[model samples]
Target: MNTRVVEIRNPATGAVTGTCQGPTPAGSCPYAGRDGVVPCAGRLVGPAEGDPRCWPVWVPPGCRQCRITFNDQAVACLRAAERYRDQWDAGLHRERERVRALAARKDPRFRGMSDRQLQVTALWRWRLSGPAQGLRHAEQKQRDWGRMYLALAEQQRAATPPVVVGGAA
Candidate 1:
């Protein structure tokens, strides 16, 4: 879940920036604990000491050079969460519109049919007469459609209101 990545910079001016995920070597620097220890000569100077933005002269042993900062990872996660939220909202809106449209218009051919039943019927009809590659293809589609239609019909019957008989004298 850590989204940190190492950044590469221009050794001359430090103005140029790039990124890399290479692993840092596990060895001590010869200049460790020496007063002469400093940022790489090519690295930029005059920046605040211990500034996270400033690239280090050398990374410590057993460390990764390509790690991203905690702040950077949090920002990235926020952006991604916002994007997913937007997508989910858009999909929900579209689905709502679809259901509304389906409810608003009633196809005479599919009167009393549920949305899925109507869709199956419509698709079957379209495929039955539309540019099918062969008669067998059309037949197969028709059979599938028939099975679906029958299943829907059975469900509808099961859910139908029972008719009442006349009262006896």
Candidate 2:
């Protein structure tokens, strides 16, 4: 989120007399603000003071960098979803559990419950409610968008090698 307005300077004085009225962030876009913008020069948070970000940027996309951030976040979300899916799948062996829990139902603790109720007790309760379904949909969309961003960046980078002028990248 470290951002600055693209600067428009005087030709002779080299002084920042005015700011660009164009896009707020001169991103990795080659034509944004006609500044041949690249990624930010400053290191984003999390690394040491000197290192550039190795991970993608994680923010909403108004700027290209923001897209990268969201892409990274999307990938992260997919990984997390996979882990959760694994955990949820662990509870699905219900028939095996019912056979096993049948013996325990004879104990005094099962005094109030019938065999059916005892068998129905879930070891790993997994339910995809409406909100959970919506989240899954959103996550899939984000992951797809993230992949698209990466593909686009790779294509553009191959087609055009960036040139550095006198200003910041």
Best by lDDT: 2
lDDT, model 2 = 0.40
lDDT of 1 by residue, 1-169 (tens): 2223444344334442544332224322222235433222233221223244323333223332222132233444445545544554454455445544665586455467776765565445433542422434544454555555445434433433322233222
Best by TM-score: 2
Q: Write the per-residue lDDT of candidate 2 for residues 26-144, one digit (tens) a residue.
A: 32343333443323322111112212223212122233332233334446656765654554444445543654465466555445665565555433232333444554566566556
Give lDDT per model, in order: 0.39, 0.40
Model 1 misplacement above 4 A: 1-62, 66-68, 107-169
TM-score, cand. 1 = 0.30
Residue pairs with colliding backbones in model 2 are: 57-69, 58-69
Q: Which residue runs of candidate 2 sit more than 4 Å off their true CA positions?
A: 1-126, 161-169
Alpha-carbon error at 167 in model 1, in Å? 99
